[model samples]
Target: MALQGPEELGEPVEESEDLDDQDASSISPAEEITLPPGPGGDEETEEALLLPWDRFSAWLHCICVVGFDLELGQAVEVRQKYPPGTKTSICYLSFPDSNSGCLGDTQFCFRFRQGSNRKTSLGCFLETTDRDAPPCLKQGHYYGYVYFRQVRDKSLKRGYFQKSLVLISQLPYVTFFHSLLKIMAPEYFEKQEPCLEAACNDIDRWPTPHPGRILTLPIMGVVLKVRIPTSYDKPGTSQLVQSAQRLTPLIVVSSPPPPPPPPRCFYPVFFHLQMLWELVLLGEALVVMAPSPAESSDTVLALVSCIAPLRYCSDFRPYFTIHDSEFKEYTTRTQAPPSVILGVTNPFFAKTLQHWPHIIRIGDMKQAGEMAKQMKVKKLKNLKTLDSKPGVYTAYKPYLNKDEEIIKQLQKGVQQKRPSAAQNAILRRYFLELTQSFIIPLERYVASLMPLQKSISPWKSPPQLRPFIQQDFMKTLEKAGPQLTSRLKGDWIGLYRHFLKSPNFDGWFRNRRKEMTQKLEALHLEALCEEDLQKRIQKHTEVETVDLVLKLKDKLTQAEREKLPVHPGTLEKLRAHIEGVILTLPEDLQGILHKPTTL
Candidate 1:
């Protein structure tokens, strides 16, 4: 464990041979004491005695400073539980300057400082007749620091603190240690070899320190000895009582406080499961190690609660992906990316704790609903099929590139008595291609809208659509439906029948019958009108042709009709009619007859 600067300076130095008797006795350091070695062949180590005012974060100070048992002692012993490889700090907590009503920026504390001359820093001093009196004990609480060196030099040290600093609440170091080793040297655990030495060799060859690599063998032993009470009954005092009762034989028990209310944030047996949840949120297809019940323990239950959603993300589990070691090996037998190559935990896992936030977030029902909503979202309606769209107005614009000039000429020709055929033909071809192109996209646009509209129609109410869109679709049923109804009915009915047969499309297919009927009826009316116009044009042409043949029979003389030379009287009529009939007659006859005869 890394030491704080002050902690190193305060290491026990036997009375500096050059000091005065009173001063030297008061300054005994902590590390000089000897203790029995446990089975591990390692001497137990202890930390300097500390007070409530010791160097700790504000959160830690608040957790340590108040509400404790104080009858036989004036200070409460409290231990800090740190992550693996981090040392446990056993400090004596007490309320100092009790006269002060509220806690503020400059709270009281005392610390031992080294150097031949520096004085001890303490929040308060207690007067005692027998030197063991608790003058600072008040209102059922302790209010001073204990000098551990003096108590221990008298061979009266208690709890695990007599030898080593291990918090009762620290996590089991072995499981965490293996989890760390897996992150640092994954291939070692993946090997089929059952020999333990290979795993150790792999750990020895680890390239660098992993994020969770703090749990070393030595720390594992200390963590094993820690025995945290299963319950918390108060803010700061209950844990102290638990430790004191276990370590020292001298603790007196008052009635224990009722257990603290259960917090809603505990997520148990979910280390790897939570990790997989993170990948799910990231939308990654990465493989991970499967979660197992044995991976969890009480020590990290609070931490798991902090980092995982617990219930909100449960839906993501079915989609979570993972692979075993053999599979990973088989796949990587060819090639693997750099990220996959690194961070291998047990050949099967490229799982990492990187970028996981320090604090856990609890997800709400609304957030889950939003996720489901995204899943519910169908592709939007094809706006191309939407009526009154800008696309309709702009439809002919692309083909109108040279149309302005041509249109101007056609209008001029109309204003004049005659139009040029060359210019008219050019304009006609341009419009034909423009009409052709528009029909193709329009048909495609309508076809595309069909499936999209069907898919989204059911989800339309809450996520509302536009007025025309929301209303019943395609309401173009003729005033009187198709007079010849069977063909039109068959076409629309075919569409509805096809829709009904599809799985899961019943609701969308529900209104198709009425809509298709309306559209087909409208189309039938247009077809009937077109047919009527063509009949009128054909009838008018037939009447004109018969009239012209009758006129020819009355005026042409039989000789002209038979193509023989006409009589002078008929010739005179032909001459008089020549100018009017020039356009209608054969060019040769008109040219020869129209020539002036010698008068």
Candidate 2:
């Protein structure tokens, strides 16, 4: 497990922009705790040992936090009192370094405990209200013993106890410690303030495998390793053993040192990047964390084994495969996210993409100009492209209908050796392949992503952003761009790498307004292109129809010799073939052919 430290996370924490309207400064420093003068004159809660080295008087708090392995929206800790579920699991990170005593700076490693292998009863002190009712053990809770020994052979009978502990917030020890952190280091114990997904305003909109969110806790530590222990192996300095628990201390698996953790968020030693999903989709895992959020912060949260990976997919299987080492038995106690594993073909994922704020059309000026020309042909302007729908695999609907009467006039003029009606129909049916291939797809793509432009972004709109959020505010405050962004190129890849990594969090949001404007312009341009396409295809079709008319006239002379009527079958067959040639041309051409015209 490549545990992350503060230096590795490099992210300074910030409150959610969504909560900006709420009093963000509501957090006051934790109330002062008075330490009882004991043998060492140190303050120690019944649950946590105080660190005298730091003035903050921080407690070495060992918490029973459940990782939000599969939490859809809210933080998993909100379910702290509840039993673990699909998106929630028991993760152990604060291992007791026997050598470091209580407060010393010691290395940390993160491990996940495998869940119950079988349905077993948990025996606890439960009082039955009815005399006839029989005593029964709870089905899911884990019961275990925790040992505490005095650093020095001091008070309270050598200060050692093998106390049975229940992993429940309602339990005394659990409550005391939870209360201790709440009172002392209240920031961590306060409501879990996870940053929103890059595009979504809340967890309700979070999409799986969309982008890696930087999960940061208010506190900081380094992640050493992630392990799922199997057999009874005592910790480095204790005789503690277990049948199903894997919270062993300091189990190091040496590998060629992994690269430093990403600079976006400060991850505790317990959690690290499980998988770089984009690479996973491409069947690889290059775990060097880049693409920091446009927002500067030092913490990212994560859950392991809660959500399911896209099974049988080489791209996502690696996420399940990454564990401590071969020495330890790997565990898969929870399933991956349902929406993510459902496959890219899922309509929901495409819908999710629409909400994601950073889909870019990286086309340069030349491409934009070319697209513009398609939208509005100066000589042949007819209709706009924006009216049609967008897609590769999403909702798509056409916007225009071919003029049937015009086609009939053109076909009649040709058949009767007349020119005017034939000319009108030919001109109207132009851009045969362009509409089928380029126009509709471009329309679909734009329509699919239009939802992003309409989404309620946390960063204010440019007009709204001007008063409170200034562009490049960091330059005024820190004299440089965001640290992570500075390392990236100044283009779409850099901006797209992490939408939040834009110069200022607000700047990032406002920058998108420009793109949205361009997208709208493109939509209008598409409308123009649709019109131009019709005109151009009509011009081309005029030539083809004229040629066909000449051929028909030649056939007429031959028919005059053979005394055969103009072959209706041959004309119908030609009309059918031409009808299927382009996306919308068939209908117009067919109408022209099938309609009767007097010579």
TM-score of structure candidate 2: 0.17
- TM-scores for every candidate against the unseen true structure: 0.15, 0.17
Q: What is the overall TM-score of model 1 with all chains considered together?
A: 0.15
Candidate 2 segments whose C-alpha is farther than 4 A from its true place? 1-79, 83-88, 93-599
**lDDT: worst 10-residue window of model 2:** 3-12
Model 1, poorest ten-residue lDDT window? Answer: 390-399
lDDT of 2 by residue, 1-599 (tens): 12110000001123233221222142222222333322211112311321221112111111222221233212223111112232222221122211223331111122222234221111100111111111111112221111111233344353431111112221111112222232222232232333211101121121110011211112222111122221122212222223233332222221111112212111111111111122122222111111111101111111111111211121111111121131122122243222111111112222333322111111112221122222211111211122211111112111222333433443354346454333422332221221122123222333333444334331233122122222333223233323222221223223223323322223323434444554443333223222333344455665575454444443333333222322335434433333333334456755665443323
Once model 1 is optimally superposed onto the true structure by TM-score, how far is the C-alpha of residue 170 displaced, in angstroms?
Answer: 9.1
Q: Which number leads on TM-score?
A: 2
